[model samples]
Target: MTSLFRPDVEALAGYTPGEQPQESGWVKLNTNENPYPPSPQVVAAIKQALEGRLNVYPDPLGRKFCQAAADVYGVDPDWILPANGSDENLTILVRAFADKNDLIAYPYPSYVLYETLAEIQGTRRARLQLNGDWSWDLQRNRPLIEQAKLLFLPNPNSPSGNSWSLDCIQKLVPPNGVLVHDEAYGDFAANPHRMELLRSEVGSQVVVTKTLSKSYSLAGLRFGFCIAQPDMIRGMRKVKDSYNCDMIALAAAEAALLDQDWMLANRNKILNTRAQLASELSESGFDVVPSDANFVWATHPVLKHQTIYEELKARKVLIRFMQFPGGIEPCDRYPDGKLDGLRITVGTDEEIQSLLKTLRVVIEDSPST
Candidate 1:
């Protein structure tokens, strides 16, 4: 009659992801998912793979898929490590390097998954707060970096979708730490990717992780990967499961990567709609942070963030909300604390339009909000 979980697992509340409603009539714009179907070629490839085999195990090294990814990113096939998703890769990395009492650092109001993984790994999680403009504070973070063994940063950070410049990131390389850059939304950012940073001699500590989920619209298939020094890649390989990504997922990801035209076209569409959504929301009395990803972060200055979140949910238009203590207050309130607000993903033009229409109706109906 004893409990069967670790003390940390028992003590902590689990991470809450964006709302994914199964019921009909809800417009889900919470998870920053791409608003288009994957490439026609991807669909065809999955069908073809399914026709051939169901009985064999997948490639443990995931070489063919890795080669395709390397071809796209200009990295060596040996440096590429594919996983079920970036989430799985993150878990493996944490397990490989982090242990109880070991330290990991990240910019707060960033990816929640890092904190979740740290808790699960029984490692110490150091949360660095962002600056007023929603950028990293390198000077303040220098001490934390010097003390930590592993560091994770989401470029064009999640929920709050802004990024740091190459110069800014270069200055942040902790002398003895493995800096893992989660580039989940790098495809949509206005800046060049941190991949260039990885190529430099100064990039010994940096590793970049990407996903087919966002730009390629392959979230359902769960294909993602990391590019690191061969040693780091090998270390993660040592701890990973035998068959991490299935044959069908690998085939679909390969096809998706090859269909660059389709990918680029949809990215452009989402970018256009994202700009329009920010502008429209701003004009309607909402203060929106400029975003480089496929989502917009906004808050009504006069309206409580939670109230807005609940209101949107009641209307069946799902969006993400952050619930930090003191709730988006000045820095002194929570130095290592994450700030919270609403994260609304950019959908197709018609889908975004529907959301806009609902917002107008809700605001007009509830004058007090």
Candidate 2:
């Protein structure tokens, strides 16, 4: 039989999400999900939406949710386009801007999904490699930056959870391309929103995508949105699904954004736990990076990163062990090659304590480590 799929599609490796065990009793932390429950209002709104709402198609534009998000994020309703999730936003961006011949560039080792999404579009992809300290060589990458049609940056990058400065971010703006700030973990940072840049003259080239999964405790509810200039939003809007978000999700997302206090309280708790977790990991001979996100990236000085992840998993604890396909260029900070880390999500105090206990035992048992 003749193959119908494109050659690239046949060769492409789809993105692999973190392990989602079917059973319970697992200290699941591989995915960075909010351990706390969403705002009480979210539940009430969802219940209300369930009443006689399923029969009809949702608002094609998701107007109500857009207005609510606008109010919360202090942006105009037209400047935001709500989506099923941030992943959907990324897909739409690729579709809207790049094609098989065009180039899509992004900082490597930040979000692997960027690579997968670009590949799915059958577009040319460029990896702007990060240095050992998670910093970029702007001069070296300037040609790609200018040539790319889209550049995706996960602020407070994943697997590292380190944030670059505003000046550094500004330097990344392309003269002819769009810069996307994937602020998935922005809620846990001291300075999350970049409203000023979005409102500035250069705002025309910047797009910011956010999600409810991490901070709003709505990972189960697929809801996210992107903020950009009204013109850019309008352009991307045409690329998105007519009714990208369902009624239930719109209700939940609106309620979640409106209840800012609830989100803030949960964020504070996670930040605190993150601090403690990083300290403990450091004490255990791990090289912990100072993080602004809800998770810590720590490489062990003695034990192998994979060994730690496997041992912890055997004991029913889950944490992320990630290595970039192309190893990062070694710098003074990272002298030893093949640097990888355990990306542990900051869960509840009890859950984290249990993970630590098991991890300590695993380390002690591994004399070879």
Candidate 3:
């Protein structure tokens, strides 16, 4: 077959998402989706929206949804830019800000999508390796940050499941580039909001990306929004699709925001489950990261991570496993070594218990244990 794709596309190994199991009996924990269902009000709103609105083209600007989001976040409507999901917002951000040869800085092993975005845009990526403790290395990134056009950073980072404080973020600000903060898991974290950081002295360069996917349990609906200066928001809107968000998604997301208590209740459940999961993993000789999100990153000190990952898969329990430090395939052998455990999502009570049982048998049987 004659290949027509660009050299960059030909060489790139694209992002791999969490496994979706066809087997019904398996306990899945790979992706960090909300375990519980969305609010009844959200369901009702979506259904109601489906009645007569399907025929008409939705609002290109998505003003109604923007207003709802702004109301909840306490930001002006002009500052809220709604997208199909946070991923869409991020892609647009890179396209709008970064040029072909321009660079973007981000923490390595943070969000896999950031790398994908950088590559697709043909922009250089300055990946700052996280310290042994999984914290950002600001010193290493200082030089790259100065020249980069955009920086994609995830707060309470995925896979690692740890958060950087507002003070920490303040100190990491790049002198000239735009800082796009991915707060997909911020709802579950202890912080009230990162919007305040943008209001500070360095307000111009920061944009906070949020999603209804995690806390509101609206992953299927694909609703997310970003908060930035009005000018930045305008730039994003200009680049986004005219009808990026559908009527049902807009209506449902609005309902979800309105029922704040419902979202809080679901978040509390996950937080409790995350605590229990982390505590159990720690006691069982796994070094579990202190998670502020809906999942925990647990690594067994002695066991090879690949071995544990394979054991879990063989047991029909799915979880996320990354090849550490610039590696592409999840199964690629780690010559330099990577974390040797799993990124387990905090599922419901019964599901978590099932995982613990299998984990106990697997860990105790390992030579390290």
Candidate 4:
């Protein structure tokens, strides 16, 4: 029997999320989840929402959370559009701008979801390959950018943890495209907010999407939002579901934004642990990327990353082992056909110590010389 689904949908290998192990005692660091719990305020707010409303429909606009985000980010409530997750914002961006076969470009080896989203929409993708240092080759990719209708770039990119400079970001904005700045790890970076770009004359063409999953310690809640000019926000609002974010999520988001101190406390702890993790990897004969996010991207000098990952997992430690098989544009510094590395999430101090201890064992015990 013939399938009713679209051909691309039928053929697509949907995005594979980070592994979630159900068993206990595993130091789960594959996913970039905040090590600390959310604020007491967030807990209290959820409890209140549970006692108040579960039957009625949630606010389609999520105005309360919008207003809180606006206050925190110095943007107007109308300029913010809340969603179930920042991933939804990406879907909406593709739906709003790109048509089937329309050009959607993004930095290669960044977030693979952008490609998955484009595939779902049957849009063309021009991978803006990073020079081996993880910097954009604006001159080389200019033509691709010129043709792109939507561009999704993750700041402090996943699996790399390298943040592109603001000047670089400005230069990569497609002249006739909507640049979706996917800042999922922005809260952990030194320079997080890019809202000033929205105030500039060229603001209309830029859309910044954020997720509470990382910094706000709300990964389980599935809440996030996008920031753009009011007009652009209105257009996106029309494209989104009537109530994409539920009542509990809205309550949590609002509370999380208002409790900045708690988030900062966690952010600081993660940053400290991240530094220690990177240094430990470096001292253990691994080349570590200078990370601006809550994780570190590194490669072992002697052992294959896959081997290291497997050994670590065997000892009840889980981390992401990633590979870009092909379709990634290479650079002179790394004139390779493919790239692979490890992305280890920043966990608690004890977790880091366990990771380092186990990593040492993996390295010392390796049969490879």
Best by lDDT: 2
In the order shown, what is each candidate's alpha-carbon RMSD?
2.4, 1.3, 3.3, 1.6
> Alpha carbon lDDT of residue 295, candidate 2?
91
lDDT for 69 (candidate 3): 82
Candidate 4 clash total? 0
How many pairs of residues collide in each model?
0, 0, 1, 0
lDDT of each: 0.83, 0.88, 0.82, 0.87
lDDT score, residue 9, model 2? 86
Alpha-carbon runs more than 4 Å astray in model 2: 14-17, 367-369
Of 3 and 4, the candidate ahead on TM-score is 4
Summed over model 3, clashes come to: 1
**Worst lDDT 10-window in candidate 1:** 326-335
Predicted candidate 3, C-alpha RMSD:
3.3
lDDT of 3 by residue, 224-266 (tens): 9989999999888779989999888888988998899999999
The candidate with the higher lDDT, 2 or 3, is 2
Report the C-alpha lDDT of model 1 over 1-369, residue by residue, as the tens digit.
776999879877865655677677878898888989999999899899989868988777878898998898887898899999989988888998888877888877677788888988888878876775676667787888877778887888877788788887776666777788889999999884756888876576888889999999988889899998788888889999989989999999999998999999999999999999999999988878889899988877566667666777898888777765533325543343445678899999988898889888777766453
